[model samples]
Target: MPELPEVETTRVGISPHIQGQTLHQVVVRDARLRWPVPTDLAANVEGKPLRRVVRRGKYLLFEFDHGAIIGHLGMTGSMRIVNHEEPPAYHDHVDLVFSGVTLRYRDPRRFGCILWQENPVMAHVLLASLGPEPLSDEFDVAHLLRACKGKKQAIKSLIMDGKQVVGVGNIYANEALFMAGIHPHRQAGRISAERLDRLVVCCKQVLSAAIKQGGTTLRDFVDSEGKPGYFKQQLQVYGRAGQACVTCDQHLTESRLGQRSTVYCKRCQR
Candidate 1:
């Protein structure tokens, strides 16, 4: 699934081509996605101009004059810019054709979505209860500390909870915890405020850096331009189990927390 950074990368990549441009057409090859694509989606956006393409967590918010299109790259979906005359492929589920360009969506798993929502989409149910973006000022040590209070859940699980702070996916959760020197399985409530501060900082740093790095592309994730991200090459712990820790010079350990693989250095993280 595309995380926050990858979504942001898509937003930035496509924004240049579609922003302020009038839509010439919309083609829906398949309406069956994670949720059925709204049948009237094309009619709502076809003649209007795109105002912006923004991202909230893993969802893309495509703002237009009349309404907005909100989509999610569920697990194996991607958007790319193609010439208006280019032919659609087998997995090309949707296309927003403009005067000179086309924004194409391809999802092999049919797990993505194309939904039309009224303007001001932030208040939609899918977005209403989401926590602050990890790179935003709204998320901080105090925020995470308050959210973690009275919880015996694993620290990694706590951070991965979307209601606590959106977009800390499995990979980022491991990286942030390792950067903070916090064991992934530590009880949430048992973590001290001081350590929570470290965790908060690391979350912001890691997330911002990942966004700059265009996300870690170990598998299906790629930037909107169809290029793989290089951040995975810099990972210190997420997938480095059985490898030596760069900081403590000890072997890193691997475990499963909340059914997600976790990598950490036992000697460095307590």
Candidate 2:
């Protein structure tokens, strides 16, 4: 699935192209996705002029005069800018045609989403309960410490929790934990506030840098320009199990935490 960085990259890549364009129409080649693409999506958005584009959590919000459109690029989903009349590819499930350009949404795995909202988007149920954006003021070390209090969950899983902090997915989680020198399996509540502070900083830095680099492409994901993210080349431990640690020269170990593969240097992390 596309994480926050990938989604943010897409938002940045496609925004300038689609921002001021009016929604001429919606073309739904397939409404069956992770959730149904609303049959009335076109009718709801046809004449709405796009006011702005923004991102929250992993979703993109295309602000319109009266409402907004929210989109998610799931495991194999992406959006591209093209001529409004471009023929739909096999997986091009939807399009928002503008005067001269169209934004095409494609999802080979059919797990993405295209939804409509006629009210404040953040209040929508899907986004209402989400935690603070990791890069926002509300997500500092103090906030993270509060969220981790008394939790027995693995620190990895705790940070991955959307209600605790949005967008710390598996890959970035591994990188952040490795940078913070914390074992992914460490009990969330037992971590020192000082160490947790390091984690908070690493999470923000890793995520911000990944977004700037267009996200670490782990197969399926690409920028709106169809370019793969370059951050994967800089990975320290996510997929380097059984390899030598970059920091300590110790052998990196692989284990499972919260049912996801985890890689860390036991000598470097506690």
Candidate 3:
């Protein structure tokens, strides 16, 4: 699935092309998605200028005059800007046509969504209970320490929880924890405040770095420009299990945490 940095990268790539441009048409080749595409989508959005574009968590918000359109790039879902005359390829499910270009949404698994929300888009059910954006000032050491209070959950899983901090997905979580030298299996409540503070900083740094590199593209993820991210080249732990640890020259270890792949260096992280 596209994580926060991936989504943010998409938002940045496509914003300049679509923001403030008048929507000339709406073409839904397939309404079957994670949720049914609203039948009245075109009526509500066609012919209006996209006022702004932004991201919250992993969702993209295309703001308009009266309401907004919310988009989710599920596992294998991607959006790209294509020429208006370009033919839709396989799995290209939806398109929002602007003056001379089309914003295309493709999802092979159909787990992504393009839905409508009223004026206060944040209040939408899909977004209402999400935690603070990982890159936002609202997400800080104090907040993470509070969430970690008295929780026996593995620190990795705790940070991955959407209600605790949005967008710290498996890849970034592993990288962040490795950067902070915190073992993934450590109990959240047992971690000292100082280490949690280090984790908070590392999370932000990892995410910011990923976004700068256009997100990590292990597979099926690309920026709106259809470009693969380069951050994977900088990853220290996530997919390098069984390989030498970048920091300590020790062998990295791989295991399962909450059924997701967890990789760490026993010598480097505790």
lDDT of 3 at 108: 95
Put down candidate 1 lDDT per residue, 117-149, tens digits, no spaces. 885677788888999988889898889889989
Model 2 agreement with the true structure over 1-270: per-residue lDDT tens digits: 789999999999999988887888898989999999988788888977888889988899988877788899989999989875568889999988888888999999998889988777788888999999999988988998998899898999999999999988999999999999999999999999999999999999999889888898788898998899999988999889998999888989999887888999999999
Which structure among the candidates has the greatest TM-score? 3
RMSD per candidate (Å) reads 1.2, 1.0, 0.9
TM-score of each: 0.96, 0.97, 0.98
lDDT for 55 (candidate 2)? 92
lDDT of 3 by residue, 78-186 (tens): 9999998789998999999999789999999999999999788888998999999888899999999999999999999999999999989999999999999999999
Instruction: Kindly report which residue stretches of model 1 are placed more than 4 angstroms away from their true locations once superposed.
Output: none
Which candidate number has the best lDDT?
3
- The alpha-carbon deviation from the true structure for residue 110 of candidate 2, after best TM-score superposition, in angstroms, is 0.5
Off by over 4 Å in 2: none
Better by lDDT, candidate 3 or 2? 3
Error of 1 at 232 (Å): 0.6
TM-score of 2: 0.97
Clashes of each: 0, 0, 0
Residue 8, candidate 2: Cα error in Å is 0.6
